[model samples]
Every structure is written in C-alpha cells, then in structure tokens.
Target: MKLFYIKAALLNTMLLSFVDDGTILAQSKQLDDNNVGLYTYNPSLDLGYALHTGTSPLKPKTYWRYLGFYFDHRLTFHEHVRYYATKAFTTVQAIGASSIDCVVPIATYGYCLWYFNGARNKGAMNQLKWMQRKAALWIMGAFRTSPTGSLEALAGLIPVHLMLKKLATRAVYHVATLSDTHPLRSMMGEGLLKRAEPHARSAALMTPAMLGKVKSTVMEVDEHIHTLTESFKPFAPEARPGDRLLDRYADRLHFDKRNPPQDRHPYLDELIANARADPLTALAATNGSVPQSNQYQAASAAIIYKGHRELERTHYVSGRVTAPDAELNAITCAVHLAVKQANCQHIMVFTDSMGLAHKAVDPSVHSGQAFSLSVCRALQEWFEADDLRCITFIYVPSALRWDIHGEAHKYVTKLKVRVGRCKMDNSIDALRSQAAHSVLDSWSSTFQDPTYRGSEFLELQWPDGRPIQPSYLNGGPWLSTFRHSITEFTRVCQCITGHAPIGAYYHRFKINKPHSCTCGAAFQSHQHILFCCCDRYSVHYPHFLRDIALFMKYNPKAFGFNRDPSGVGSLLRVGLFLLLEDLSVN
Candidate 1:
C-alpha cells in the first residue's frame, strides 16, 4: 500500500485504488480518446468497458463505488449516505447488544473524506441521525413518541454529530502516530510533528503551520495532543519477534493476586510479619489518588520498609495528572527506592490498582510510558544484579485498608502541596479521556433539559442513589437490568418514556376516555400509580430498581392495555368477594 501511494504520487492524475480495482480521476476529455483501444473506459462519457468475449458492455453508473464509498462527479456523496444509512438501519434491527458496532461504523464509513473535511453535511448528518434514531428505538424497544435523546441515552448510542466528532478526533490522533516520512506528513507543517517543550505555547497556534485555508487532521491533533519527546517509537510490526520491550522484560516482572487479604489489620499484620522474617526482603506499598472535587490535584505516595524498620517514604503532588499517571508515578517511586536499598533480594509491592501495576511494566506507547520505562529499566538492573533478586506485585484492594497500603493511600488522599503555576502538559490518553468526559457531560446536560428529552422522560438513579448519567460503558444502566426479557424490557421502556397505554397517556392523546385510577385519582401518572394508587399499582417512592423489576413481574398487566381501570376494579372486587366466601366456608 505504501508502494502504491508512492507510485501514485509520481503520477499527475488522481488515483484512488483499493486492492485490484481502482478509478483514475481526470478532467481531460482527449486523454480518453488518446488512449484509444488501449483502455476500454471512456472518460468523456459514462461508458463502461465491454469484455473481450462476445458480451455486451456493462451498464454505466452515474456514480462510482470505490473503497465502499459512493462518489459522483460533483462529490456530493448523497447516494453513499442514503445507501449505507438504509443498510445500517436494516442491519441494526437484527443485531442485538452489538448494534452500535454494526450501525455506527457502517453509517459513518469514510467520514474523514466528507464529514471532517467540512463539507455541507446537513443532509448526510440527517440521514445518519435517522438511522441512529431507528437503531436506538429498536435496541431499547422504545415507543416512536419517545424523545430521540432519551432513547439514545438508554440505548447507549452517542448522538450522530458527536460520534462523528469523536471519530474524527481519534483519526487525527492516528495521523500523529504515522511515520515522519509518510505522504501525509509532508502536507502537515514541521511544527505539528515537532515535540513540544515542557512549558511552551502550543506550536500549532503559535506558528503559521499549514498553507491550506482549511484545518487538516494534523492541525486538529496538534491542537488537542501535546507531542512528547518520546512519542516517536517504532511501529509494533516493525520489531522482530522477542525483540519488543515487553517480551524481553516481562519475565522479570510479576503480578501476584494469590493469597489476597480477606480482612484489614489481621492480614496486614501477617504480611508485615512475613516480610520481617526475611531480613533481605524489602516491602513496598504504593498508592495514587485523584479526588473527584479536583482532578488536577493528583498525588502519589510510596512507603518502603527493609527488615523490621521503615527504609524511606516519598510522595509527590502534581497538577493535571490522571489516575494512571499518578499510579505509575507511585510504582516508579517504589521501584526506584526498592532497587536502591542495600542487600535487598525479594521485593514485595502492594498496590490498590493492579491494572496500573501491569502498566508500570508495559512498553506500549501510552500515557505514563515515561514512568513505566523508568520502572522497567530500574527493575531490569535490579534483576540482573543477582539471579535470585526478584520482585512480586500483590493486589491490595483499597477497601481492605491494610495498614501499610492504607497509610500510603491516606497520605496521597490528604496530601497538601502547592501546585506549580506553570501549565502541565497532558498525555494523549488524558486528553482523550477529558474529551470523552466532556461529551458525557454534554449528553447529561441535554438529557436534563426538559426541552430536549421531554418532561415525561423518567430519570433513573444508580444503586448508590446518584442520578444515572448516560454512558456506553457496561451496556448503560437502564437496559442492562431487564435486557434478558424482551417483554419486560419493552414494558420498562414504555413506562419510562410515558408512551405506555396508561390512562394519562390516553387522555393526553385525546382518546376521549377516563384517565382516573381505580382508587379514584383525578388523573393517572407514573409517580401517582407507583406510589399512591391501589395495592397492585403501588410501590415505594424512589424505589429500588429490583423492586421495579419485581413489580413488573407480579403485576404483569399493570401497565398493559389489555385491561382498563374499570375492568381491573371489577376483577379486584370479584377476588375480594371470593376470599370472603372461602373464609366463611372454613
């Protein structure tokens, strides 16, 4: 593919090729005539090639389909959007929980070409939005009248426009990872590819970068991602087998989760006693904390002990540090201290975050790679010093609050240090996380506004009683509960959307029928029925989701259209009379 790109660069015409099939784009009419019998395609007219065998010419299309994207002479891409939108909508209907995978990529295929390039995409976006709305409705079994925003929230679908923005932003990041000698690199100015100084203004905005009037993906990435000095690592496939950083050093590092602490102080005492028994063993506990009140105020602390006495303790407070960054920093501090200790053979590291422990040894190009690389280098020397010198990382769940680990955790949590005035540089991962969080905040805000999600949309809360925010993480909060049963899921959806066949809903639609409950309430409502209505319809206010599920199970026809209020009332009276008669007989 690189060879093809290089070859195409030498030519004057625009060549868009995918594998064996491709299209040659040109504005010259005579070029086609000049080729004559050599080439069968007519550039002057829409004429397809005729096979050499006794066969008719293939039908000429107004637009060409190349690389799964449709394009006409004018580059409208209207047919492409329409075709894929319909295809994705149909595919979404049959797809289960993974409908997002099927629809999003299909609908937004080649978006960088048309959408991110800043084309007049109102029509295209509308088509894509329609596709997404249908998919959301189907996924949640939501009524047609349900607000698109709420349905999308419950269905775990990002809005179409935002999804495009996210994809385009990620594509920009990908371009940053490309080789310096790549063709796209030449189009981007040198400033974008250069590593940013620790505390300097962004090169993207400070210098006149691109000659083009429109902003390219490289410029966009530069605006968001600050390039690090160690950003330009060789691509993964370029490395030879067993030559990768992780492959060579992974054996020296160990992650031990066995013999986990069942309780707090007792288990912690045993661990400390075991370490004290071995005079040559060094024990280290590290913790990192990023408080919710202020994400920028991150702190990492590590405590080390040799024999029966504390060897050293260190903690650093930094601004704009992510949880992983802080965690890796703590690990790095612990590793550095442990390796420096005299006569240390076996080192035991206890951390609340086991994932970050593994990352401390990872060689991937990610946030906190600098810290990880430092720890790996230190451990490499420590292990090479003596054959038996090894380290084990043990998982200590923060909830356990083991004595040593808890101390480190507490220090970081309550550490007070003046943050430097100089602005901190965020890693690519941090920037991406910030962007995702911003998108979620926007979604939550939109859902909260009655004008957007409609007043009737049910606001659910997490088990902790915090209001549930929209997220694709773990299949969203609402649908994951009743997703096992389609019928139950549909009923829940209807109730939340206020599109169920209840009395209030009927009255709102002007059905010209009674809207009162069996208990003679003026009007039936979600809150009224769930709390104030008769026994069958009543449940506690701010009820547990489990209770809601049980309520639906016990009163199967509570929210269904099968029985009206009068019918339910008659059934209740008849059941009461039967109970009385049975009691008299007994």
Candidate 2:
C-alpha cells in the first residue's frame, strides 16, 4: 500500500511538470490511457490522437477550454455554452439558496433551460432578445413588492447584446490601431478583413440575413462604423483621392476628414465673390435683422446684389429706431437701400438667422401681429416699385454660412464692445438661467442628504448643467466584462435615496409582512443588505463586498468615490448594484 501511494504521487508530480512544459501529448501517449480525450465537432476528420509522440493513440473529446475561450471541434459553441450555463446555474443556486425559495422564478428557470435547448441555435439578435426577455422577467420577480408604476419608471437596463457590442467595438478599435505588419494581422489574413468588409458598406446594402451573420467583435465594429457613417453622410463629403487608403478600417473612417475641395459647396463661390468685391458691404448684406426691438438704441442693415462677374455693389444702412419692432425696422431699411443703391434687378438676400429669414419672406406666418403688419407692407411696396424684380431668401446651414455670418458676428461684437451701448433685448440669457436651475433641482433630488459634499459627482454634469444620470455611466472597465440589468442600477439609485421597495419601504405600504430582516435587524435597509445581513454574510454578502473593493480599485472616479472618504456610502451602493447585476444570469 505504501509503494502504491508513492507511485501515484510520483505520477501526479510528473503530469504537472508535463503540463507546464506543454508536453501533455507526450505524457498521454506514454501512458496509453484510453480515458485521454480530444473533443471535436467534425467526426469525419480523423485527427489521430498522438501524431508527434511515438506511442498508442488517445481518445477524442467533444469539448474543451483553450486559452480562456471555450471551443469544440465542430466549431459550434453549443457544448461550450451548455458547460458555462450549468456552472452559472449551480453558482446562483448555491449563493441564493436562503433568499429564493425552492420554487425558482419561471423566468430564471426558463433562462437556464434555454442554455441547454435553444440558445446556441438562435442568431445573435434573437439570442439577445431571449436574454432581454429573461432579464425583464427576472427583474419583475426580484422586485415583486414594488408598484408596477415604480418598476416601469426605471429606465430599461442596458441589454447584454449592447454590452457585447460595446466590447466588440472597442476590440475592433484596438485591432485597427495595430500596425500593418503586426503578427495578429498576418495570422488573421483575409478572413478577418472579409468578415469586417460587409459592415463598411451603406445600410441599404446591409440586408437582414447579412446582418444576422455578424457575430464576431470585428463584424460588430464594422456595423457601428457603417451606421455612424450613414448618419453623418449629409454633413460629411463623399470619398476623395487618398481618402480610401486612409479608411482601411472602420476606426480610420471615423477620423478621416474630406479633402478641402469636397467641403466647398457651389453656393460658396457666389458668397466668396460677393465678399471679395467689398468686405464691408458683403457683411452688411448677409446680416440678419436683430431679434429685439424695444431696447435697441441703434440699428444697421446691409444688402448685396450679384452680377455677371463680381457683386454689383453693397448697400449699408445705419439709423436710430424709435419703433418697438426692431426686426421689422431692419428688414425695411435693408430692402429700401438695395432697391436704391444696387444695380441688379434680381436681388439675393442672405441672412445668418433662420428666424430673420422666415420673417423676411413671410412675416405673417412666424412674426408677431404688429411686426408682421409693418414688414409685409414694406416688402409689398418695394416689389410694386420694381426696386427688385425677384428676391430670393436662401437659408444657409450654420456650418455653410460660417464665412458670411461669422464675419458679421465679429463686426457686431466689436461695435458693442467699443460703443458701450446696450444693443437689444436678448431673452437667451434668461432661458439659459432657467435651464440651469432645472438641472440643479433634478440633481438635488437624487441625494437623500442634500449636503453631501462630493465634487466628483458634480464633475460628471453635462455642459448644460444637468447631472449625467447613473443609467448613462456603464461601469467603465471594471463593469465592462459584467453586463448589468436595468433593475440593478435602478436599485442602486433607490438605495441611495432610501426609496427602494426593500423592508421598511415595502412594509410601510403594507406590501410586505415585516420591516425587520430574518437576522432580527430592526429594519432591512440598504445598509443591512451591504453590511448587516447575517444570512448573506457567509457567501453572498462577502462576495459582494469583495467585488465592491475590486471595483473601487479598478475605477474610483466612475462612481464618484475617488479621493473622497465621504463617498464611501455612494461607492457601496453602486457596488451592491453591480454585484447583483453580475450575479444575475442574463
């Protein structure tokens, strides 16, 4: 018996060494063990168990893990998925035994069954839809005590498909950044490029069947790029010489700007000619009527006429306005000047402001009754007098109108600075102030204690002053591998605000039988879940805390916990939220 134990120990040691040295094949061949397996999907192809090692053959396996990725010889992920699904189900059952009754939620059970039955058979989108449905049902069961309206209030959680898409997009970007001579590129060859190429085409060409086949990260990256390009096509110019080479991949295409010639529109030629003839006149002619009337001390108007080669002439008019309607006054002034000073019969009036343009053409439609009456009369008088045979109001987009409008804006800004005179009644400042207050009120409501001094949260505010909602903060790198469900993040928010459908909150509404936990805690609050729950301490609670520490270590600022000891509560709340999501089976 002693000799047999020693021999077994020696064999185990030798096997470990062989595995470390990547010589498992040699050891397996020497043993001639029929139990040695080679997993594969293709039964027709005979990959002899031990080719290099001179010994008896080893048996084949149907599935195995290689370099962190699950694989099967048949190239189908069915077996691989089933293995993981079983492991996950077991883990969930072990940890949640105390909380969930023997009868598992139908949704959770169905999700487990899917891994063995239909999950592998479906396409990516269909698979994602199945997971999403399961997720929604799981959330409903988890927060069963919450009101239906309250549950509905929570924004739909980021789906597993989207998380995968984001990761895949990032992976594509990483690959695209690699040098042309990188080893991975050579190994991938045309297979990688061919798979990604379909995503580079226009959306019209990307058929549903073709889209369904896009399962890999590379393909997802391509699809995102294609979608973005299509959205920006109107703003972005068509491809030019050398541009195609620059856009070898989706990432490259995102940053590739059109050549100078392509960005210049044909209308720009007329505007440029008009400007070059007389810079001052062109600036005045293109300027829009001021929006305000009552407070204006001085007003200015300009007009430009296009001729065969250059601008015929520019007309600039400046005067004081006693009238309350400044916009109407400016338009009347410009038209009278154009008819008197310009040579051309057909006149073109270019304006930077869309409001002014609308009022100039049809004042009765968009302007106030008082302003409309005056502006319409003036325009009709000019046309009847033959001051202008034809007048066209061309509305140039802001980017396209930069040269004309920008110059006018600069001139006006300088004049206002030098004269120290109040220009007009501008309501933009009042509107901006109102918007800022609204954002502040919304943010304040999120924190139970309004005095919580954490500048980190403030840093996440949008340019318009509205706080970036927690839903938008997809847990950076730490949470990247773990996709969260909608209810999970919402729970975090509820925890922080003390509004969750947990013990006391539900008990108060008569939804639950008791406010106290099984551990005899006075109230089963968010704090109890994180720190005081005795039932969860052994497995669920400890694991959750460890995940929180890991998350803080990975990205402290993402959850507004960085460099602030006071933010510990916020950090734990977010951590618990993430842990619940990580544990939940999609």
Candidate 3:
C-alpha cells in the first residue's frame, strides 16, 4: 500500500511537472489568425494529442525502482540507493524548476535553427551551449551527491517532470476534447497516430536562440500588453459610467459619469450595433439554420457591424479530432504549408506528443532520431526583422475541455488507432496524408480543402474582387510584412501638430516657418532644426519617423526625402526619451 501511494503520487505529480506557476506567459495580440489551418487553440484540436501524453500515470518509474520496490520496497541497501537517486533527482529538478522554463527545450531547439544563417556564422551559440551544458552538468552533479551510486537510474527523471509541468497546465485538458465525435479517434488519438508522418520533425533540432526567447518571455507578460485595455476602452460600450465595472478598476480605468475618454464609445453599444447588421434572423435566411453545435464565431455581431476589418490576434483556437495523427501532423503540416512559402511571417508550433511527431517526421525515435526545429526557427528569424516581429508557440490544455464548447462536457476522448486492415487496407502513408488535410472552410488560405473542386470566377474579377493574398506576397518574409504594416497608420496622432494629414503640407508650415527658431534661440534653418526642437515641439517628429519607417518598408513612395520641423499641440512628460538628457528645461 505504501508503494502504491508512492507510485500514485509520482503519477499525478509527474503530469503536473510541466506546469509553470511562477508567472503567466501570454502571447501578443498579433497571433489571432483564423486563417487556413484548423491551426489554433480550439478545444477539439487536442483529442489526438491527449491520448498520447494525457495518459494518466504519465511518468513511469525506472525499471530498477520497480524491481527493487517489488522485492523489498524500502530501507534496504537497494532501496536506500533508489532513495538516494530519488533525492538527488528531486534536488536537481528543484533547481531546474526554479530557474528553467519547460517549453524552453523545444523553443530553443527551433530558435537555434532559425538564426543559423544558412549554417554559416555562430552568434551567442557557444555561450548558450555552454550554459546548456553546464545545466546538464548541474543535473548530473546531483548523482555525485547521491551516497549510493545505485541512485544513478533516477538521473534524468526529475528534470523530465519539472519540464513537463512547466510546459502544460490543467487548462490543457479542456483543449483535448474539442472534436469528440470525429471519425479519426481510433488511429488518430492514440497507439499509432504519429506513426504515418515519416517526416514530421520536432522543433528542437532547428533553432536554439528562438527557444531562449521563448524561455525568457514565458515567464512574464510584455509591457505593451499591460496597456492593452487602456488603449481599447474607447470602443467598448457594454457598461455605463455609474454602473460598476469601471468602479472596480477605478485606478486602472479612467472613465466616470461625465468624463469618459473623449473619443471612446461603449463596447455594449458597439456590439448591439454590430448585431443589427447580422441579426440571427439574417444568418438563418442565408445559410438555413445555423448550427448551435459550433461554438466558434467570427467577431461578435456588434463589432462586425462597425464595418471595420478588426481582428483579434491573440485568442484561443480549438477544434475536435478523433482521427489518428490529427493533432500533430495536421497542424504541423498546415504550419509547414503556410510558412514554407512565406504566406505569413513567423509561426511557433508546440506539442505534448512525447517525441511522437519527432519520430514520425524522421523515424528517429528509438532509432536515434532527434528533433529538428528548422521550420520554427526560420519563422522566428523572419519575425525578428524590423518589418516583422516574433511568433510565439504555446502548449495549452487538450483535455478538461468542458469550459470550451458551450455544452459543458467534461470527458476528453483519447482513443488510439487500431493498426489493422480496413476496407481498402490503405498504407499508413496514405492515412497520415489524409489526416493532414486542412480543416479550413472556403475562406481558408493555406491548408487546401480535400473537398476542393475549384470554383469558377464570374468574370475573373468582380467589382469586389475575391479576397486573395497577392501571389508575390506569399514568398515574402512574414515578420517583415507584419512589422511594416502593424503600426503603419495605426498610431493615434502627431505628438506635436496633432495633425492627421491633409492636402499638401499644412499652410501653417509655409507661412509660419519662423525667421528665427520657434524657441527664439537660433535661426529657423538646419541649426534650429537640430538644437532647438523642444519636448513640446519635438515629440511628434520621432513618432513620425517611426510611422514613416513602417510605411517606407511597404510603400517606398511614402518615404519622403525632406525632413520638416513642426511642433504643435504636444507636451513632454518628465522622462521623454527622445529629448536628449540635457534638454530638459525643467
């Protein structure tokens, strides 16, 4: 009974090993793409994956421990040695637990490959490798502390648990059950799902630098995200001033009965208006009755009614799958297809597959196949450009999907594939390929539909042309493309003039170009342009420069040759970085 309790504790605690509790790491809002693949964080996407690693009693005891426990279970020489091993492992893992990130191994692997620069030059790699090697030694050193070398068998087990829990959380369970009724359950969910993908590579062998970033960022939220709600309150109309939600966040939120932000509208009102445009009645009229079973929807009716192309970038994507390999190969294939040609910027892919996909893609499992994170690293490098940013990969819950679909179902289906003859006795190759079919609807871009028969254009170009990514753009780097476009015209305004562009330069510039500098110090030519630009007058120029750079990357026409000096309608805060430290008149 004591042995059973120990094993049981190891089982339950082992799975929790990967959970990161120190700080909640969240991705940027830029990742909410509901494009071609079923590639997202849907509750159903985890079904096939869940069966593989979501198994209860996730970690196994060492072979020696099993035998030792079976023979005598405790306090004997053999038992003490095992105890020593366990204690050493626990100490090593505890250090790793406090200092390491669970998702790091995969992230680093993929990241290193991305920056390999055609395998030509080496950057911080030697140092990073040294750190990793030392970390490995740190782990190995635990054994020296073990009085009996008999504890050696437990050498690596604790690190495994520490990493796993730091990676996945209880929330992952909900993601595991999205597609409970899908047909792929048998072969897709367990036993042999990743068996077919003979080339599915893991993210480790590809990039190491990228992985390091994931490790660092996985521990904390970004500063930009801290201000997200403050920047968006203008569009939300759900609550009234005196009513309450605003009161709770009185410090963080700045609205009141009479003093709402000048340009903001309520979210509830916007939703109501958007709802009007696509009343439930209208959707029923066009598409028969809408399926209540589907929980996913585009932006809410109210927001959609606003007639804007606003999209939520960071959101939970999910789907249900029962097919073998549907969880791993399908999403990975979609990422490959989407990014191989540069359809989007960068993409990060994560899995709890326990080397299943790693082995499938390379047949390296057991045969000494290692993870190759090349694809993911390439994506990261592409995102690092001034034009494109970074793409983060996250591993989420694939079971306990109860909170996902509105149905509130608790059980996640984790069936395994039965390798047997079917009606056609298709090869695993064919089955895996079929499993990788894109889950996109007609609107999808990357994952091609298995049911596609090709649609005819009315005249090849309608008045409103069919939305298609320009074929040329597909080959461009996604990170650069997104970076140049994201902040292009999105920022609020000129920090000085408060101008939102008009016909030609404002006449105020032509007439008001002062004979002497506005600061009354120097002549208003190049000298004034450099020395006298004050915080009150100089703030907007930097913002203009930033926006201009974004624009120039995409539309070179916007990169004007001339620089102008105009400072109006702005004040510098105490710590404006653009102002030289000496310029603060205060």
Q: Could you say which candidate leads in lDDT?
A: 1
lDDT of 2: 0.39
1-586: candidate 1 lDDT, tens digit per residue: 6765564455443344445654554322434432332133333433433222214344335787766889875676888999989988888777776666756777877777667554677888998888888887777666677888778877778788887777776666556556555555544544554443222232333445433455444456555554333353434431345654457656656786566545545665777798879989899989887777653477889999876688899887745567877788898899999999998888999887778888887755666766776776777677767988878888888887777888888877778655557676555565566667777777777778887776777665433345667786666766665566555556666666766666777787887777876668888765555445664323222333444446446544332112223334432322222121111101
Off by over 4 Å in 1: 1-12, 15-61, 101-103, 117-119, 174-176, 182-184, 194-212, 227-232, 235-240, 244-246, 249-251, 259-268, 418-421, 461-466, 510-528, 531-586
Per-candidate local distance difference test: 0.65, 0.39, 0.26
Q: Report the Cα lDDT for residue 136, model 2.
A: 34
Q: Regarding lDDT, does 2 or 3 come out ahead?
A: 2
How much is the lDDT of residue 523 in candidate 3?
41
TM-score for all predictions? Answer: 0.77, 0.32, 0.16
In order of TM-score, best first, we have 1, 2, 3
Q: How would you encode candidate 3's per-residue C-alpha lDDT over 110-168 as one tens digit per residue?
A: 22221221332133233333333344334333212121111111121122222222223
Error of 3 at 578 (Å): 23
The total number of steric clashes, by the backbone 3 Å criterion, in model 3 comes to 86
* Residue 303 error, candidate 2, Å: 6.1
Model 2: lDDT of residue 41: 16
- What is the overall TM-score of model 3 with all chains considered together? 0.16
